[model samples]
Target chain A: MTGFDFPPPVMPPGVEALRAEVRAFLAQSQAEEGWRPDSDFGSDWSASFSRALGARGWIGMTWPAAYGGHERSALERYVVIEELLAAGAPVYAHWVADRQSGPLLLRFGSEAQRRAILPRIAAGGCYFAIGMSEPDSGSDLASVRTRAVRSGDGWRIDGTKVWTSNAHRSHYMIALCRTGPAGESRHEGLSQFLIDLEGDGVEVNPIVNLAGKHDFNECVFDGVTIPADRLIGREGDGWRQVTGELALERSGPERILSTFHLLAALVEAAGPAPEPRLAEAIGRLVAEFYALRAMSLAVAGRLEAGALPDVEAAIVKDMGTRFEAEVAETLRRAVPLEPVAGDRDGAGGNAPSLASALGASVLGLPSFTLRGGTNEILRSIIARGLGVR
Target chain B: MSDETLRLIEQTADDLFAAESGAARAALAKGEWPEGAWQAFAATGLAQAALPEDAGGAGLAAGLAVLRAAGRHAAPLPVAETMMATLLCHAAGMEAPPGPLALSTTAAGEDGDGSTVRRVPWARFASAVAVVGPEGTLTLRTPADVVEGANLAGEPRDDMALSGPPAAAGTLPPDTDGTLLMALARAAQLRGAMEQALAMTVRYASEREQFGRPLARFQAIQHHLAEIAGEAAASGAAVDAAAEARTPFAFAAAKARASQAAGTIARLAHQVHGAIGYTAEHDLHHWTKRLWAWRDECGNEAHWWRVLGTDAGQGGGAALWPMLVAAGTAGTDAAAAAGEGARP
Candidate 1:
């Protein structure tokens, strides 16, 4: 069988120094800002923290310097993002932008769009929300019903985007709207637009999650007008562009490290000398973590080498997300503590105690495998890659 | 050796192993040494691949790559055991002996010269056995009263009674970890075997029809194949990481992950193949059975899991991430090589 080539990752020079710098910055920021450590990126967002990180050139990494990027290696970007996630840093403000949107823009956005928006993203002053999913479209993203009609000199967007994370907070959304008919394939005749979230006839209603938090929103677009130049790529190339960025969105350390905080807390609770069974569980999880990280890093290395390893990226997400949920369950069964939702305030009052971290993780576990793409869809992608479909 | 040369050697090894597949199956069935296959492998001088560069051998990475290809075919021989034995022999300044080599990790008990060592892989076929321990390395040319044993795959794993002075004796290198190396070898083999199984299962699903359609068309079956593919990919990545890093932590992680994947991959592969996969006539057993045997040979998931857990525990919670990063990136290049293709 011809296996996917995931060559071992090579760390760039000065990576360790960069890692140290990020760590020192994070430690100091956490101390000074007094922000509570969240379970994952979605649990927290701070504009100041994102701006501070961007000022250090962590965001917009691996992009061309002409587009306000630091021109760092993908591996360097990997290390910085990995550190942020592992420390439970408040990175949601710039997460989508740094991960996929900026790269998408650099690759497909118009010149004026790049010059005007990319620098603001690099400075972490601008945030982006994805507008691919709808009330009818979840896994079958090609079945999106959102339509963009040609009106005046611009386009009028008239559809609703559901489960849009932070649409209320994000400045712009690259919405995949139907610009033409589905001739032979549904993936055809689709286009992406850089719709301003604050434009006329735009409404973002919060959808409280299971944990009683408002990270997601249902955005309604009623004839929202956008400039003609706001199109991300070619009019009919939206499907290709969106699929192109899946490798970037699916293969990062975020998929697996969502429960990292819980693991660290479990280790702390287990103490220096845990029981044999407890140690075994923890060790098994840790080993899986290491292997999954290696796989993700390998994919990042491949992407850095200019190969779009979609199948490999899907495998990473499939295994990594399962590992994430397994971590939560393993902790719940192995640790002898009841999960309790701690105080709502920041770390100044009550830090994320072990119970609270576990609580947050349990509540957030369902979305781990469901978000980005469902585990079923990911497995289907892998199966297709294996030529089974 | 340069990567180009290593790739060529790997290709040659893959072809040789593919050609020897029949001999491997026959040898296992008859419980005899695959003399033709062994001779063919020896002619390639792959045993010396893991030796020091000054010793006219390629580096560890090349050696692991060769072993990985060998494991890919499930060649019924002691390729890993022999390669590692030769490494120890050369490091100890002993001229490497001919024929297949068996490896043992158990130290000589209170009886010393007359001690009994168990679970020696391919002991009956071995021309010489290398017994490595904390004390040093010892080579036994002959053993008295060999009790024949076989793993699930029907490869020899005999018990031997040693009753004489060693043919060669020398101190091991400071970094020589016999168990870790053996585990790494098995991990590589597991990676190869899983890939083969995945390929076989994928092919079977695509070709075999059920209810007037290929089994692969069914979402349930496709998902099974997908899980197998996922595990195989993870196992390969883990093996590659460990081979590049060569650290205790890396090896432990690799073996544990591979061993863990071994169970799921074997189960899913068998499930997807249906009854045909379980029968002895089908070649799928050649890979699946070995996956079972290899997972427990050097160290299983549970064994290595404890090693990693204790490591993390001793380091405390704060040190987990750093330790993982160190193990994952150990021995990697300082940067991507210059002149590589850039992303568009």
Candidate 2:
């Protein structure tokens, strides 16, 4: 069979102008506010930084004007995100809300929910955390044990969510909970609840990562009251909604850009000309990265057209994560020492610039293939798409 | 080469292939040349699809339509090898073989003889063999004793013992082109096998349920399938680009990419399939086994990687950017040419 045509990722006409505007804005922000890039190992939630970005209409650029968005195409947003991530901007505050939750709510939430949350998300005043993974239901989301029982005109939720990234800092968490007993199909009987983290009955405890960072949390809900209207989409449709949301979460520049900092460090360390092995490794890595980026963009194009590129998205994530892992490995091999103190501040230290970053990346790499949906899961989907199985 | 021509060729092959039924598979099982199936393909001029118009061939260009039929059906004949042989002949200004010829090659140092042409592992099934000697001379040799055999698909890989002067000799340029062609062909076959294996695993996952849900619903299975799919896609694109490649460096890159993808995809397929896939009773073995053989048969991953690595070194430290630019242009040109060739 012939190979599908995958054109290289280039800015659409006028995209260069958009890039210039963003770069100017970022440059000014960097100079005026002393904006240091976010730490590679920690979960960052900088409200002021996100607010500045949102004020510039960069948070939800692809959404409609009514929702405080600029009505840009996904490709434009892609370029914007790439620049943001490449610059290591402190975007974690609005990352989930803008990257996925806002889009999800826009698509599946009730009109009231959208009207209430969309603007705040666009304004970057609000943040969201995914409460899908429970202690027992990280990958098998359908096995979520969180329960939400009807209480008068609202629901009382009681369960614990593990690995809730930035839950302590998020304004709201969209939790996938069982509204009823497990149905014949595991995916049935599940519903999503939008819980306010500041509410009285919710407790967010730190789940320190391997880097000893409080980026993730174990969020316990003890009879947390939520209005019935807070449910996303129809009750018992959590699986479909979550699956759609994952299409947003898993297929993006983030999967590949996790190693962008390391790449930059490598370029700096190697100078104009690198060692033979390092050069070859970097070359292969860059080629694969380019290919993976193309695939991700292709999926984005398909997603924008309202198509369910489930298999295609899976393929992108699998390849993207593998490439990131490879980059991490290559960097580790090329430079063996640790990044000395003040390396981030450019003190001309002998420390390995990527040492701390590599530590975090290595710990995080396993989850790249395991989290969202494991690599194996995506492969099966691809296999089915090919009609071999 | 027009779209209409490509469509016509594919349609014709599809029809003839449909009519031929299980003859190829049967021949494969019997370790004999699928002569009947070959005749059916010859009648449709598939053997000469890539040959020039003057060579009594269909003059189809190198592309998907020409390769798809062979891949989809797992045709038991050496259609690709023979096409490469025909191209070599044409390039050497020699007449292409008329009918029922099998083309094969031996690695530079692998054969038993120090100077004489030696038998390759898969050379047994050919009626005639094209041997390219170390001096860059190409020879068409007919062996004395022919023994029927099969490769991964049970397709015939007849054995022939060669012991005579090389016939119909012509010289190929002492460059990487011949080796590149071999690598490309092997990569193409690996791509085909990967596609089939992926299809098999996915279908199995959907239909095969455990714990009351389809295997596909499991995250582990999905991840496995995704890896396989990604690798297969990468391999397909790489090999297709390699086939149309002009430069040795471009060929090296494509070969490296394809070989890595093939090995990874095959292993993932087997892992997803589990016990049944490991057994000879299941058809999954057919694809996986072939993948293993094909990956190592031509220049293996290490060999090609070194070639690419050495090439990069020679071009200096900043060689990567230029090499990538060159590869991209070459890939685009080949794609455009293939597209043009498929036009009516």
Candidate 3:
């Protein structure tokens, strides 16, 4: 039998209370700000919104309270993230820091780094972007030519990271730069350095995305010197450390709930007593959402049980990302949505609310598969685990 | 039930298939009944496993596991139908009919106006057909004068015209959902069939050689297999969730998800298997064809999709997520419960 097991995760039933709390918090927060939910949760960055969430003790929920966290159960965190993603909240600003970086710092960072960063992340005042992808190295993280050479008691990082999300607006970045020799293993001798975005040698150039948004950037690191303490984990432990972070990044509700706004819109547009075809389409999307959420929650449970569900995480990412994209395609079929370039000012036009949601979803569809880890890469991970090669 | 008992059930089902299904599949494809296999399946108590403890049967989950095994083997004995019959008969506090059984919800004319259910599965072989409808549950002996029909899988789906005096077995409770129960049954079978298809495809991809290497070495085949893995895994989770919860929405979602996956899986498994999969000689068609038949049997994607979708649609935009949560479990929602009762 294949070694992968997604045994229906057994979570205590108390998470419903947490889910209720999250829903209530979101309802009150969204109403108070008069903020309508959006489809593209990945690129929607609202620092104030994140701080409000942090004040509610939602950010870094599962981490320890000593680091400005609530020290709650993993399911509670799952509820928080699940609600945020479903509501299509502006979670992008503190998303990276809260989801992976803070966790990574708690596990692998120096004491001082953890003290300086974890509380700020829990406060939603600190934001971080992943610096794994480079101009030439996308999925092939080991081939990153960006070198962090040792200098006078510090490292001079010099590499250009492309497709760096939120780097222009974020406070810091965790760049996976080569620190030492490649040796025999291609993954050897690399290191992750915490780069301050406002550092002297750093330049952030914007890359307009399909939605014509300024969420992505090309980050150039030219002799950006940082103290040795800025390096996350040991010098040669970058590959393993980053893999763990990616695992944290991959299996979450955000991957599957990106187009939830469109789903709600589709149901609303169908009105009461829709054609059988329309109702079925809406039902199918909701069904897929339910199934994927179940799977995602199971994976989360596995992670909470202190097992690294790398293969399971890959399955969730591969399936969850595709499910999000399929939501857009099915929405197109349901409401005839078209992809239109917008300057992020809500695509102002006479387009119906359904059409606007469809367009937003259509624009974000390609990123669904491309971001986090490409479907191709995640599949390779699954293939490797399946012993396909 | 303890894990040991469930493992025993799985082991017994596994041994039964290992001893019989491998040889009987060819005969089954030819529309010949596998009597030996059927006897072995019944002897193991899988056919009557769904009956309650007072009725001398295993639990629902245990029986579902066996049903999945039956599907895994593509066992052509109507084991799933027999299990359903055993449960219905037990629920009615009546003795199960002899031999195999079929199920139908089609209403029969009381005055013998020749109203008949077409494609009643295994009608020609079964001793009785349980006709469950909103009116009541009627156990009708399989009429001798029946026109035999087979689905894409060549399983016996004979048309039995309503005739003679049928036994008034029992009445369904106001909340008993024949459709949802059948949907869960078919979903379990689909999950089992898809798992086998995936296992077969993965094994084939690993062994079959192309371009001086195993087919698994090729990225194209790997991606296809990966997709199959995702669908199979997701379907498995859905089934387990529904089985664990046993709620109306859970079963509905499971059926919809499994049926949705089965549609793509049949094609992808064949695509991975290439031209050889098209032939009847290969064992792949038995499962794939069964998937095709099973996907539409209890409730296809459209049937159950619209059921849950109309509920969400009727609830309007603000009620969407809450409706989803309520639909996923037997949550405290009077409106959603009302919707569940009204589902066909």
Candidate 4:
């Protein structure tokens, strides 16, 4: 019988030192800056904080040194990112570029594009937003109506991408567009281009989320022109390039630790010696977390060894996202506190931080399973992996 | 052991059990010990695989791999219990008794009424039972009588009434937690059981038809099978990680995860199989029933959850992170030692 293989990860050497470095940096940043720790990665964006991580050589860690990377292993990068995520650090500015765009460029971008954009990304001076989702397309990405036609020495893109997080703040967008006939398969004739978000005929309109945040944007491209070299990989190979990185996209600390601050807060509220029942609740979540981490690490280890392990990665995301959502619901019952709108001060005469963290998590819960492909989509991917569909 | 050797050992054990599947089940139905199967397995020396080289055994990795295969086949004998007994005896500086064995932890009260040690797997068939106390004291006993009991899988779980003093007793090695070891054993078995259940369900779903297409072609059915696959994978990874780590916390997490997966995997497996899987005639029950029984064996999800939660909550919230980070490397030395201990 066929089965998923998650061999034990061979951890990179000297990770303890690297873990120490990340922890110390987070502690110093929290103490000195006193930034309100975001409960999740996408909730907050701080350019300076991104720059701080970049200056420490933590971004683009696994890429070549020629592109401002540290030439570190993926496991090392995993250590840094997990540490940052667990602390709820403001990693949004460089998150997309560091996580997906930079790696994509390293894999499929031209040398000129790499030399130009990768260094900026590693330095945390530049950021990117995904332009795959459009007004007519979310999970059915192949149905995107965005069109990029060949113009003299360049390409002209015209389309609107919805749910484009941070499109306003990002420097560039990797837009997937139909460059040729649909042919027999809809996935055919699609291409990805590096469109400058600030170029002419581009518009960014804010779409407020349930949390009263402007993280989501609707980006409109009215014939925006990009250089011919901006095409990522080969034209019409967009589907493979995008689908190839699901393992990298889905199986990360971000997927699991999105609501970790809530769990941490619950632990804090439980105090030094919680009741057995409350401890059990906490322990239940921790046990799930422990197992999920091992699975995630196994996938990461496989990725570092150049194996996709996409099925295993999908399992991690499906379970990890559900676990993330479960944390909030469990904490609501486990911790007897009505979530308050975060006041950002102690004037409320209550455990404001716990209540506020709980509040943020509850509000952010919907996106846990929605963003980065909904749980249904992930389950389908897992089923395909099982060869049952 | 190298990956190649481990694969070879597991393959050998799998072949042996596959060949014995019919006889093992026949013995269970007849209410008699499968003496032939027992002798055939014992001749392999794989039972002592976890003992040190000086003790003439393979290693912990080999031993756990063998347990996994035993779980896959739901081997009727007390293979895991015997392995634990052998390891306990070797740890206590004593040679294990020959024949099928079970490890028991309970002792008769001072009242001396000969009240039985309840639910010890294959206890009636065991030539000797190694009882290890919480403080690492090992007492090897030959039971005076046995009352037959069975788990949901119809595997022997007899009650042994101790009458006289132990035949042999000694102190186990320091810091050895018997319950944790048993939990690890059960978790490994659960991993194997869940995997087998998933494989069976996937095959059934692929072959069975409804609405003019295979059941696997249905989205709803596919999702159910997918969830089962996730649980199985998580359980397997958890057991492997716990074995490699060998810490009490790691073992607790493994057992909790496995026990947690058993319910969902069993339910989904049966659901995908429809009426056929629920019947006693089908082989799927061999795995599902064992999953239901094995989950509550060492400790259920609630029991281990408390242990993990309490350990996680020490020294307030800030201390939890360090403890978790430390847990990643908690028992690496023990695991590495167990691996190298059996090497020449």
| Between candidates 2 and 4, the lDDT winner | 4
Q: Estimate candidate 3's alpha-carbon lDDT, on a 0 to 1 scale.
A: 0.78
Candidate 3 residues A220-266, lDDT tens each?
88878888789888989999999999999887778778887777877
Per-model interface RMSD values are 1.1, 5.3, 1.6, 1.2
lDDT of 1 by residue, A159-246 (tens): 9999999998999888998989877878898999997887655799999998988989999988788879988889988899999877
Docking tier of model 2: it is incorrect
| Predicted structure with the largest DockQ when compared to the true one | 4
True C-alpha contacts between chains kept, each model in order:
0.68, 0.11, 0.65, 0.65
A209-308, model 2: which lDDT tens digit per residue? Answer: 6655677799998888888788889988888998888888877777766766665555455555555566667656654654465566666666666777
Pairs that collide in candidate 1 are none
Steric clash pairs (candidate 4): none
What would the per-residue lDDT of candidate 3 be over residues B13-96, giving only the tens digit for each residue?
867876888767767766677888888777777776765554566666677788788788887777777777666665555677
**lDDT at residue B319 of model 4 (Cα atoms):** 69
Interface RMSD for candidate 3 relative to the native interface? 1.6
Residue-wise lDDT of candidate 4 within A1-389, one digit each (tens)?
55685667878789888999999999999877766665488867899999999999999999899999999988898889988988878899999999889998899889999999999999988999988899889999889899999999999988899999999889998888999877787788998888887765579999999888888999888888878888999999988888775556787878888888777777777876879898889889988988888888888888788877778888998999899988888889987877765565453431336777778788888998988898888889999988866
- Pairwise DockQ winner, candidates 3 and 4: 4
Q: Chain A TM-scores, all candidates?
A: 0.96, 0.90, 0.94, 0.96
